[model samples]
Target: MSAEQLPALVVVAPLVAAPVALLARRALPAWMVATAACGFSFVAALALAVQVTSGGAVSYALGSWPPPWGIEYRVDVLSAFVLVLVSGVATVVAPFAWASASAELERERLYLFYALYCLCVAGLLGMTATGDAFNLFVFMEIASLSSYVLIALGRDRRALLSAYQYLVLGTIGATFYVIGIGLLYLMTGTLNMADMAARLSDISSTRPVLAALAFITVGVSLKLALFPLHLWLPNAYTYAPSAVTAFLAATGTKVSVYVLLRFYFGVFGTRIVLEELPMSQILLALSVVAIVTASLVALWQADLKRLLAYSSIAQIGYITLGISMASREGLTAAVVHLFNHGITKGALFLLVGGVALRAGHAGFDRLQGLARTMPLTSLGIVIAGLSLIGTPGTAGFVSKWYLVLGAIEAGRWWLAAFIVATSLIAVAYIWRFVEAAYLAPLGGATPRAGEAPAAMLVPAWILVAASVWFGFDTSYSVQGAARAAALLLQ
Candidate 1:
C-alpha cells in the first residue's frame, strides 16, 4: 500500500483481526493474530509519521469523497506523533499480553481476551487517526467498551466492581462528549474537525461555542481521569488483568489526553480556550492538587498495582500541568511526558504483573526481599521506579526538566518549586517498593519465587531500558514533542 493508505491501515489491521482472533477459538493462534495486527499498525504509524514529517499532512477521504461533506482521515504532525505513541505501546504490550493472559485467564476464555485487546487497540488508534469530531467520539466508545470488558476479565472479584464503576462514569463522560460534539455540529454545521476549526474561528466567542468548550473540557477531563473526576482509575488499574492493567494504564488515559489536546488547541482556537475562558487556571489548580494528593495517597498503598495506579494519576497531573501553561515549552513538556510516562508506567505494571504471577499477589507483604528471588523483575521495577521519581539520566528526568523549564518560562517559579517538591513525594512512594524488595530481610523458610519467564521479563525490560534510553537521547521523544507542540500552537 502507498503512504496514503497508512492512516486507514493503522486502525483497520487490528480492527479486522478482532473477529478473526475470536473465530480462531484458540489461545496461541488468537494471540499470534492479535500481535501481528498490532505490529502491522505500529509499522504503518511509523511510516505515516515519516511521511507527514517529510512532506505535509496526509488526508484520506472516505470513498474518494473530500472535505466537510465526506468523512476524512487526516494525519498531521501532532496526530502522527500521537499515533506513533499509541500504536507503539499497543505493539510492545501485545506480546506481553499474550504471556500475561495465558497465566491469568482460563483456557476457554483466551480467544475472547485477544479479541477485546484488538478492539481496544483499534479504538485508540482510530481516536488519534480520525479527523472528524463525531468520529472521534465513536472511536472513544469502541475503546471504552472494549476496555471495560477487558478490566472485568481480571482474576480478582473486585475487577467486576472496578469495571462497573469505569463503565458508569465512562458512559457519563461519553454522553457529555457527544453532546459537546452535537453542539459543535449544531453551531458549525460541519463534523470534519478542520472544517469546524475554520468555521468556528469567527464565532468562537459565542455562547453555544463556549458551552461546547465547557462541555468538552469536563467530558475530556473525566475521560483522562483529571484529578477529582479520577475515582474510577485507581481501582480499575488495581484489579484488571495484568496485561489489561498495563495496556490501559499505558494508553487509555494518554489517548484521552490526546483528545483533550486536540479539542483545546486543534478545534477551539487557543485564544478562546485560554484567554476568553479560564481553563488554563482551572487546569493548573486541579493538576497541582492531583499531584499532591495522589502522591501522598500512593505512599500508603500496600498493593504494588494500587501504588502505581496512584502514581499514574500524579503523572497525569504533570501532563495536564504542562498543557495548562499554554506556551511552546509547556506544550512540549506535556507531550513529551505523555510518551515517557506511558513507557515508564507500562514497564512498572508489567513487572508488577510478574510479581503477582509468581508470588500469588503483588501486595507489599508478598514482595518482601523480592530482589532475592525475582531479581530481574525486581531490578526492572526499581529502574522504572527511578524513572517515575525523575532521577537523573532517566526518561522521567527529561520530562521533569522540561516541566521546570516551562514553569520558569511562565515566570511561575513557585510552580517550578512545587513541581520539584511533588517529585519528592514520588521518591517517597517509589522508595516504599525499594525498601520492600531490596532492603527488607526475608524469613528463612520463605520459598524462592525465582524470576518471571523470559517472555514477560524481556517485554517489561524493553520499556524499562527505553525509560533510560530516552533520557540520554532526546532525539525522538523531545524532538517529536517539539514539532508536535509547534503544530498545535500554529
Candidate 2:
C-alpha cells in the first residue's frame, strides 16, 4: 500500500468490505471478507503509527483538494495511537466471532452480522482519523447505528429492547453533538478542526463558543456512557451477541473518549476547557462518582455480562479521571489506559463468550464450576480479572499506577487514596467469579458442552497474552501515550 493512500485505505477497506460481505449471502464468506478488511485496517494503522512515530504527523487530503476547502484525514500521535487500538481489537475480535456468532445468532442473519461489523469498524476508524469536526460526528453516527443493529442480533429476545434503549439515547447524543458542531461552524466558519482551532482562538471566550463546549461535552459524555447517562449500557451488554459485545466494548466508547479529548485539548485548548471554565472539575466529580457507584453496582449483578458492563463504566471513569487532571502524567495515564482497559476487557468478554456459547447464557447459575469444563476460558478470565482489579504485574496495574502518580503529582492525595480504595470494590466483584468457577461444585446449571471451539478460545487468549506482555514492556503503549499527551499539551 502507498504511504499517501494508507489513511483512506484504512477506512475505505472496511467500508467497501461491508458491501461485499453483505452480498456474499453466506456466513463463512461474509466473515472472511469482514475479517480480511479488519486485517487490512490493522496493518494500515500500524504502518501509520510507525510513520507518525518516526516522522511527526501524517496528513492526507481527500480528492486531491487541500485542507480548509476539502476534508482531510490526519494522523497525529493521539489519533494514530487510537487508530491502532480500534483496528487491532477489531482484527482480534473478528476471528473470535466466527464461532461465537454461529452459536448465538440465527443462521439467516449471519451475513448481515458481518456487514454491520465492518461498518462499525470503519466508523470507529473514521472517527479517529478524520481532521474535520463535522466528519467525526458523521462517523460517530455510522458506528452508533450499526452497533444498535449488531446488539439486537442476539438470540435472546431482550436484545431488541436493549437496542431500542440505546437507539433512543444514541439519537439524542448525536443531535447534541451535531448541534454543537453547527454552533462552532457558525462562530468559526470552518469545519476543519485545525482551521477551527486557529479561528476559535479569537472568539474563544464568546458565549456561543462556551455553549458549544458544553453541548459537545454532554453529548460525548452520553455517547461514552459516563455516569448516569450510562443507563443503556448494562442491558445492551447483557443481551447483545457475545461477539458484538466484545467488539463494541473494546472500541466504541473509547472512540467517543478520543473525540472528547480532541475537542477539549486539540480544538478548544486547555486554557479554555481546563482553566477558564470548570470542565476539569466537572469531569473529576463525575468520574469519581462513576467509578465508585459503578463498581458497587457491578458487585451485585447476577448476570455476568451486566457485571462486566458495569465494570466497563468504572474503567472508563479511570480514563476520564486521568483526563480531568490535564497534567502530562494524567493525560498519559488516560491514553494508555484506553489500550490497557480495551485489551483487558476485550479478553474478559471473549472468554465469557466461551461460557455463553457452552452454557447458552452468562448468568451466575450458568457459570457455576465453569472451570471444570472450560478450564482455559475460566483461567483466562481470572487472569484478565486480576488485570481489571489492577493487580501487580498486569496491564491494569500499569494504568492504575500512572493514575495514582498523576493524582499525587497534582497534589490530590485524597484522589490517590480513592483510586486505591475503590479498587478493593473491584476485587470483591472479580472474586465472585473466582468463587463461582473454581470453588463452587459442578452443578446442573452448567451444560454438557465440553468447551468452546478453538476458533473462539485462541483469539481470546491472544488479547489475554497481550495484557501480560504490555504490562512488562511499556515501550509501545506508555511511550505512545506520553507523546500523545505531550503533543496535546503543546
Candidate 3:
C-alpha cells in the first residue's frame, strides 16, 4: 500500500487484527496479538498525523471509486488529532489491560477483551476517517457494540446492568443517527459528505433539510452524552473495568463530539445550523445546566469513579458551550479542551484504577491513608485533579481561558461569570477527593497497602506528565486548534 493510503490502513489494521486476536484466544498468544495490533495501530496514527500536518488533507476513495459514488477515507487536521487520541490511548491501555484484565475480567475472556477493544478503536477511527454519511453510522455501530461488550465485562455484577442500559440508549441514539442519514440521502441522493455539502448549499432552507438537521442534532447530542440525555454515562463509567473506563473516558465521547462537529460544520454548513435555527441557544442553555447540575452531583458521589463520571458530564458541557458560542475563539476552546481534558481524565482514571488495584476498592472511604502508601500515585491524582479545576499553568487552564475569552468575545459577561462560578464548584468536588486522600485517617484501620504494579503506574504518569507538559506548550494546541477552527468555519 502507498503511504497516502495509510489512513485506511490505520483503521483497517486493527479491524483485520481483531480476528487474529480472537484466534489467539486467552493464551499468552492473545496478549501478543493485542500488543502487536495496538502497537501497529498507534504507529499508523502517528504517521497519519505527521502526514496530515505536512500535506494539508488526505483522502482515499474505497475500491478506487470516486466521491458521491464510493466510500471515502479522509484525514484532515481535526480528524488526525482525534485519531492520535484514540489510537494513542488504546496503545497505552493495552499494557494496562495485561495487569488489570485478570483482576476484573474472566481469564478466558481476556483475548475477547482485546479483540473487542481493537474493533472499538477501529470503529472510532473509521467514524473519524470516513467521508460518507452512511459509513459514519456503520462505524458508529461498530464502536458502540464493542463498547457495550467492554462494559459488560467488568468485574462487578452491576456492570451488566450498566452495559444493558447503555446498550439500549446507545442503540436508540445510533438508530436515530441512521434515520437522519437516511433523510439526508433521500433528499440529495448522495452519501458523500463533501458532495452532500455542495448539494446542501443549494436548498438548505427546505423543510426536508431542516428536519434532517434536527434529527442529526438530537442523535449526536445523545451519543455525546449531552445534559439531560446523559443518564447512562455515570453508571457505565463507574461500574466498567478500570481499563475500560480509562479508554472510554479518553476517546468515546470525544469521537462523538467530532462527529457532531463534522456534521454541523462539514455537512450541514454553519449558517443553517447556527444562524437560521435556534441550535446555539439550545446548546448554550443545556451546557450551562450540565455544568452546574453535573458538578453539583459529582460533589455528592461516595464513589470516586462515579464522581469522575459525573465530572466528565460537566467537562463535556464546557466543550459544547464553546460550540454554542459559534465564534472562532469558542470553537478553538472546544477543540483544545477535547485534547486537554482527555489527558487529564485519562490520568485521573488510571490513578483511580491503580488505587483500586492496591486497596481493593476506590471509594473515598476506602482510600484513606493512600497518600502515605501510594505517594506517587496519589500525587499524580492530585495533579490531575488540580488540572481539572483549571488551576493556573495546567492544560485545563488554557482551554478554560479560551472559553472565557470566547464568552467575552460573544459579549456575554454572564457566561464568563457562570464559567468561573462552575469552576468554583469544581474546586469543591476536587477538594473532597484531596481531603479524603490526604487528611482523613484510615477507615479500615489496617495499614496501607503497597503501590500498584509498575505497568499501571507508568502509564498513569505518562498521561499526568503530559497534562503538565501541555500546559506550557501552547504552540502545538494553539496552532492545531486554530487551524481546525478555521477549517470548520470554511
Q: Which lDDT tens digits does candidate 1 get at residues 1-490?
A: 8878888899999999999999999999999999999999989999998899889899999778887788899998888888888888888888888778898999999999999999999999999999998989999999999999999998889999999999999999989999999998899999999899999999999999999998988888899999999999999999999989999998899999999999999999799999998999999999999999999999999898999999999999999999999899999999999999999999999999888888766889888888888889989998999999999999999999999999999999999999999999999998888898889998343238588888888889999999999999999889889998999999
Tens-digit per-residue lDDT, 165-202, candidate 3: 99999998888888888888888999999999999998
Model 1: runs farther than 4 Å from truth? 443-447
Model 3 Cα shift for residue 340 (angstroms)? 0.7
Q: Candidate 3: count the clashes.
A: 0
> What does the lDDT read for residue 409 in candidate 1?
93
In candidate 2, residue 41 scores what lDDT? 95
TM-score of each: 0.99, 0.99, 0.98
Residue 286 alpha-carbon offset, candidate 2, angstroms: 0.3
Q: Which runs of model 3 end up more than 4 angstroms from their true locations?
A: 445-447
- Which consecutive 10 residues in model 1 have the weakest lDDT in total? 442-451
Residue-level error in angstroms, candidate 2, position 428: 0.5
**1 or 2, greater by lDDT:** 2
Measured on C-alpha atoms, candidate 2 has an lDDT of 0.94
lDDT of 2 by residue, 1-490 (tens): 6997888899999999999999999999999999999999999999999999999888999998899889999999899999999999999999999998988888898999999999999999999999999889889999999999999987889999999999999999989999999999999999999999999989899999999999999899999999979999988988999999998999899999999999999999998998899999999999999999999999999988999999999999999999999999999999999999999999999999988888888999988898898889899999999999999989999999999999999999999999999999999999999999899999788866887899999999999999988889989999999999999999
Q: Largest lDDT belongs to which candidate?
A: 2
